[model samples]
Target: MSEQVIAAIDGSEFSEGVCDYAAWASLALNAPLCFVHVLDNHSAAPSEQDLSGNLHFGAREHLMEELSALDEQRAKVNREQGKLMLEAAQKRTKAKDISDSTTRQLNGTLVETLVALEKDIRLLVVGKRGETAHQASGHLGANLERVVREMHRPILMVPATFKRPEKVLIAFDGSKTARKGVEMLARSPLFAGSECHVLIVGAETAENHSQLDWALDNLREAGHQAEGAIRAGDVDEALQAYVQEHGIDLLVMGAYGHSRIRHLLVGSTTTAMLRGSHIPVLILR
Candidate 1:
């Protein structure tokens, strides 16, 4: 299969924004769009009922039949709902002049499905908060961390509102992952017209300055008007402040600088930045 930009839709309020960003990315990268909706079978399964009150053999048989019928009905309804969500997403993509678009309703976890389709995906677009995450107060999407940790491709987490990015901020820490992010931005047309700003959060050291200067030169050589800055403070706080003060439309950063276990235990800077930023975040692995 050819590479495509995949959008994860869950029929939530943020689905439209996800579709918008996915369409923008598809057009920018000159790639086809694929919208996927997963019918989490585990979450959708009907609960078992207590039948101790009337446990006759015929009653038990009848109850089992009823429960089976209910399960079937629920599965049918879920399939229909997922189909509707995919159709709506497809229509939105087409409205954005993205005619080469397709939709799929998978019957498993989002991460598993994406992993299976990893080879065919150039980018993955998802909402900052999913349907369940929005219902839970002050909680990031449960799948956000896992998906970023598991997927090897770049993932774009779209916010509730869609904004055309004019200025893009890249959070650089001079790691190999961060360097790869810079190189990806330099080569990809996704941010072609956006002003690029490379922000390094640390004290002014010769090595730091050299890295920033090198990154700036790389972006400039790629036909982008780019600049670099050094900030001294907590990584997340300084990055968020810079984004807000400079009116950054999109935030780009490396994913999983530390091990997955460490990130799960103490939280990674990437996750913290995503939780703090109001703008869309592009996480590169």
Candidate 2:
């Protein structure tokens, strides 16, 4: 069966880049590409006011008028721009031999629409930061982490300048976090024929190295062809270099690599990877 790839396009440059990445993946996997643009009604709506106390001035009426005009303008642009984005993305992936293409303009909270569509989506490609996100926040889009936490499916976050992926890098640490990622690989026919490189970092002890090897052995047993290496360095740096050197298209790794609380306090290897790595990342928590 073919995979279903969903690209959440918000008419922002970052989101448009996400569509590009999604189209590339759809082409690579011979899957269908679904472009979704959610019109956020909640954000566009006006907040409730106390009519009992505010009967003196026409502030509420004025605010309502302004909000109505804004909503009208936003809705109009969303439909036209959304259709154009989907059409352009379709044209970009002409080589995919796509079975079909789908475009949706959903009206509701962005997360709600995406969650509702999650069951049928195999891969969800999103922008690292949306139009509203600031550069100095030291993170991705505000809703990005939330979606990753809530969505049952894997999310591939594409940076604004991301090029087409050439290879995939897998970061394994033999933990349940990593186990979830392995499970994704096990069930995913999308990656069956793709090239995968596995990296196991911080195997100081002989026993530790043995466990890493066992994980690689399990992957090989699962019918995936992977080349692996044990590296001695900071896990994030090693993975970053591997990605850069191999021209990796995607970096797959476990979220909260180790010591969740410590990670929360001082950030984790995955956080570092997000901050440093230029390629798209597939994070499994």
Candidate 3:
């Protein structure tokens, strides 16, 4: 990993958010920024079979040539558009004083490209929805879950706009993976000055209390203004309510905590929270 913050950009409203947030993260973590635009290759491999069965040989060859020319033109146009988008995004990042930021435009599936480039990516920023996600209000990006599952890195999911985060919320469930997320937060400087509130949504069992205490103490010892609490209710509902009540600006959680928080991503809890949250969500693996 070379400390490169990769922002997955597309021709969607969320791309602007991704660009701005990526710039913020680059500044926060003192990392280089790379804006990558992966073309949506709704895709079929080319076939070299001859088409002379239905028409005369000459006519078939002419048709094939015409089709090949059209394909080439379409591909060129798509690549040019991708290039323009990358340049414009890089130019916009200058407003954040990101003059040295770089860009990359890929011609493949988004998730695969990101995963292929994962080794050098310190942090990945992306939008919740893609450009074609015009079906419903909160339609998720098609690659969201796949990226979470395939990539072994932190992902910052954002809306169509960017916000300067002040208060942060960490959803802890006492699972080993959740504790690992807590440790990552405690060690990260991305939210150095922000207030972190850790909460566990479960019965106030002795174990739960101990888990919460351990999380809070860890964060506190790491020099964070950490606060923790335990709430009872549906995990998503309780988390959404807490986020709103506390005016949390960023929501952080583990991608999938095996023991108590496995449902977070494997189930619907993580999706629900991601859909409900208006603030940025930092997902740790």
Candidate 4:
């Protein structure tokens, strides 16, 4: 089977957007699209239960049986709900002209399920927030952050709404990690036709200028219509400003890189760009 662009949907408000973006990637890469909905099995542990054995023998057995039945019932409902979500995701992809897309309904933690299928994944698409997440929380759903950190394949983390991208931004910081992002874009057809911008948020030092020139040259050589600039400000502030002023539809970056740009993914202001920006993020490993 061909490597698949997998979109992890969970019937959340962001599910539709995930489908749309995944469809775009599937078409661009000429890969199969698979919609996956994993049943999150994060239930209360046995340790958290009332296991004091304070009741009579028959009462203890009855309580254990009741709990088991309840758990079974909940899993049953989740299975049916996941099936419907997969079907809806398939419909959405079909409407995008991806008639041959597939879906999988799995019972396990999302992270482990995706990791097991890692060998077959060309790209993974997921929503920033999950069904249980609240918009007012102002934080990324825990699963999203963990997946980005652990998954080996490139990931496309989408927002609650999506628009076909017209412009793309690379949050380059002259780090090896950031350079890897440039290489990923140059090799993939996903951003082949979109206008690309390489923005370095810092002083326009001679070294910074050299780094920008190197990026532009590499992208140009790879047949991408790319340009570069060095702006002065904090990494978070400058990036946010440039995105708004330039109408960037997608933001690309390398995770675990160096400096403030690096901090944007793993530092105190981890969500500075991923959560702050209104566009989808393409995180290259």
Residue-level lDDT for 108 in candidate 2: 84
TM-score per model over all chains:
0.91, 0.76, 0.89, 0.91
How well is each residue in 17-105 modelled by candidate 1, as lDDT tens digits? 89999999999999989999988866756667687575876887788898888888888888899899988888877788987689888
Better candidate by lDDT, 1 or 3: 3
Scanning candidate 4 in windows of ten residues, the lowest lDDT window is: 41-50
lDDT agreement of model 2 with the native: 0.69
**Candidate 3 lDDT over residue span 9-50, tens digit each:** 878888889998999999989999999988764453366676
Question: Which of the two candidates, 1 or 2, achieves a greater TM-score against the reference?
Answer: 1
Error of 4 at 161 (Å): 1.7
Q: What lDDT score goes with residue 282 in model 3?
A: 87
**Candidate 4 regions with alpha-carbon error over 4 angstroms:** 44-47, 51-57, 135-137
* Model 3 Cα shift for residue 169 (angstroms): 0.6
Report lDDT (Cα) of residue 122, candidate 2. Answer: 78
Give lDDT: candidate 2, residue 162: 55
> Compared with the true structure, what per-residue lDDT tens digits does model 2 show for residues 1-285?
354889887655676578668877777656678888777755745566664465658876877788778888877876687678777766655544553678777888778788998877878988876656645445665477567666877788887775754466778776766766766765565566556777777657786577666766666777766676778787777877888777787788655455332252134222566765567887655
Between prediction 3 and prediction 4, the one with superior lDDT is: 3
Query: lDDT (CA) for every model shown?
Result: 0.83, 0.69, 0.83, 0.82
